[model samples]
Target chain A: MSNSTSNTPEKDHKSSYRAEERRTLSSGEEEFFFDVKTSDMEVNMGPQHPATHGVMRVLIRCDGELVTGSQVHLGYLHRCAEKIGENVEWLQYLPYTDRYDYLAAMNNNLGYSMAVEALMPGLEIPRRAVLLRTINVELNRIASHLVAYGTYGLDIGAITPFLYAFREREWIQALFEKICGARLTYSYIRIGGVFNDAPPGWLKEVGHFCDVFEEKWKEYRDLLALNHIFIKRTAHVGVIPKDMAIDFGLTGPMLRGSGVDFDLRRDMPYMAYGEAYEAGAFKVPVGSGEKGELGDSWDRFYVRVEEMMESIKLVRWCLGVIEDGPIIGEIPKVIKVPAGEAYVGIENPRGELGHYVHSDGGKVAVRCRVRGPSFTNIAVVEELMPGTLLADSVAIIGSTDIVIGETDR
Target chain B: MELQAIHDTLKAAGVVGLLGCDEPRPANKKEKDPGRAGMPFLLVDPAEIVPLLTACRDESRLQFDLLIDLTASDPAADGDDLWVLIQLLSLKYRHRLAIKAHLPKSALSIASATAVYRAANWHERECSEMFGITFEGHPDPRKILLPDDWKGFPLRKDYEFPTEYHGISCE
Candidate 1:
């Protein structure tokens, strides 16, 4: 990587033109040899701006069309869910996790439940239940990625992709409703296992949805994933440096987008995902930058698109092995977690959603902290967002696919 | 390569009296009373955190580069002693280790892990505000999930929740 002011010029492409200070131009308008300007426009970009992705305000200072610097204002949606976790019993707090990443509700439930289960000694989840959880979460991943794909398209001014993404999301939601009777905030994944077993046709319906999804996901790829406008808007924009990505604790697509071949499900191996990965049912899709430079906004967006396909393969594998058995574990109805502390990190659509449960020898947890991935993922923008086009801010945030619901929580 | 073996190496390297300086044991297996316990962690002195963390990251054998998570718990016992959880994972070695620092609430501060792990900035800020534990020497120690005007640390075990704020009732 050469030292250049020209868009940090890609590592391989070094330009000889030095961005030096000094010089004058024709006409009355002066042009400095370097691009330094005295004046900067400070714009408040949102707590409500659709592009900021839900109640996140970025105070962006720009020199003409280029953003000079920015400061992010968060906590517009802080409900103190962790404080509430201290008051509620282990099982009672399931709904709270749903709110953290409402887009990937089942994944949230899975992470929290697994954390609590780790506190209990010799607690075993039924084989059928684990399969059911793997399937449910992968489906949720597909659903969440669809929203990412759609909103990313929307951010780049492609409205058709949003509608198409939601078209698939609605179908996934319908399947979830058949299982747990809730579309957005389903508190179905209980601590021991799930709230209930799959309804009679739910498995078959999900299996059928997988078949439809394989073709539809590629249809989505054709719609906006490969569209020229989307590529131009995203490729090479908001390129996250590898060191910054790891230092900021970025996970999920954001880390993978930077060409880091790590996913907790595959590397850490939890639930049935370990078995699935070992059986070659799924592969971790790292960002190779087929459309643009690695770690760029395009790679971030492309990672999510590729992950949905990997999820489809995992779901299909899970559907094939899902057996008939009890869904819930042998947890006490009162749900008293013995005095202990356990932390479990699960791979979510956004990244690693870690749940820290500290029990105080009672029914309720002493302190329950949620390590929301979006919370960490959003921090990188403070460093990467500057020195980019003002319009590309929307592109960067969309590619990051942040749900401020979790970021602010 | 494993966390237990690394601890043995640390002990051999003269890093003792951790978890409890003189008394280190799991919370459930304290021997005063016995029950099933979760993972056991070592307690380090506040001053030793940065150096230990540096060694943990730079040491070729125990290269715990990723600080997976950092949190503090307000146990709310007699002495106002607070517990901080530092979870570490070595991406290259594939092992996990945790260190618990018992910071006396009278001071409520310790060396910031930011010097070792840049990711601790936000986590430290959140810890500072929520549990009232300050990560001393943190570059940006602003409140993360709480407002600037917020009064008390909400996650503190004994902290009271305000029934109202300004002109609005919280209920």
Candidate 2:
């Protein structure tokens, strides 16, 4: 209920108190009794809050219900992943990569592996291994997006979609378990190739999953994306303009939601994405602001939902072309990368996951820097939160789809 | 644009501190590795970082609107200078350029690139706290990923890891 809607006698007295004080001052008499002073309240909404999605604290200063200022406090979950990367050997650092962005561990593994591989001049990834990497990465992308979709629904007070989204995500985890024997942080994508190939009937099972996911994707769209309540809460809230989005260095759905039409997978192709694009496997979906303002929370959320279908298409295309061959490349167990520095940026589900490796032509790395997308993408929230309502701030944070592991890594 | 062409354009635009490009060309069969195998970068003086980056963003032919990454890499523990690395991307031209600025330990300060690109705000903050390189003119110069009262620069080569924090054992 707003102050204007409630016309109680007490509120009328409080509202007219200031004018009455001015009028009495002119008459040279003091009649000040009511002392209703309201100032901006400082609210700490993080470090243990569910809306934060992880251990992040936002020190929000609000005037009544409107947020006046916000300062994001991080480092609660910082494990110094980069410091660990520099200390560990070239191949031994793969498992550490899985810990950062634990939801999309495969993409993290691929990013770290690709960076190390770039420093090795003679390393060649096998064809079958490349296809498998693409398939697993895309599958992980779907699983990551599903979590983003489901959690965003929960953030908007829709609970059923959370369970529905998790059901399909479990299937992807099961498929990963069959191959790598780990559900969440599967360090399957090794340096030159994958740790192992898909099991005998794994590809066919993936095909079945693609078919079932296509049907469920529509249900998700209807249940949450097109729901009136969800649209109303998200549309026109936390709208990031195109130039602002680029200026903040937002990637993935956040950038595309502003209609930037740039995807590292399509524009700056790596892995099998180039061939898949040439084969007309999938199309990059940019938000057209069908519901409300462009680049709002709804557009960003919708882009993640739509990207799930495109990922399925890319997976299907990879399933069509995967041939029987060696899965892992011929590299020594203890590897020594050449003396050089290389930076490899890949399209993680959240955004651009970059790994900059500096090697001394030895067993250990000199410096390892990870430019995590969540770390950069989360900076925009400080700009978006001041003018929005308290609830809309949660919606905006959910739309960013940041993993604290990636943000603090 | 290619690295060579981008270098020439910066020179033509009268952007100072044009300190030659470091292209990662393949070494000879019998030659030793030069520790340069990734993207080509242009080395620049630490004092001219702001104007050179502003030129890169303002030049129509360059139009490097996106600041991809801003970081500092400590090449050696005993080295006198720290290397400040900046990565820029142009959505219009779809090309990338890397800029490296050498900051001596005696004077580890440079103009903040936040004036040219807002994305550099957090990146510069992280670099300052990590490498102890002060970004002069930065709006908010605070520790990003570490505690406000934290001790030493962890990413520095010679820094020692803390044994305890607030009476809790870190080891």
Fnat per model, in the order shown: 0.55, 0.65
Provide the lowest-lDDT 10-residue window in model 2 chain B.
B27-36
Q: Model 2 clash pairs?
A: none
Candidate 1 chain A minimal-lDDT segment of 10 residues? A8-17
Model 2 has an lDDT value of 0.87
- lDDT minimum window of 10 residues, candidate 2 chain A: A6-15
Candidate 1 stretches with Cα past 4 Å from truth are A1-38, B12-17, B20-32, B77-79
Give Cα distance to truth, residue A383, candidate 1, Å: 0.2
Which candidate number would show the highest DockQ if scored against the true structure?
Answer: 2
Q: How would you encode candidate 1's per-residue C-alpha lDDT over A176-282 as one tens digit per residue?
A: 99899999999888888887789898989988988888888888988887877677677777887677677777888999899888888888898898889889998
Model 2: residues >4 Å from true position, as ranges? A1-37, B28-35
Going through the candidates in the order shown, the clash numbers are 2, 0
DockQ of model 1, rounded to 2 decimals: 0.58
Mind sharing the TM-score for model 1? 0.92
| Candidate with best lDDT | 2
Docking category of candidate 1: medium
Displacement of the residue A378 alpha carbon in candidate 1, Å? 0.5
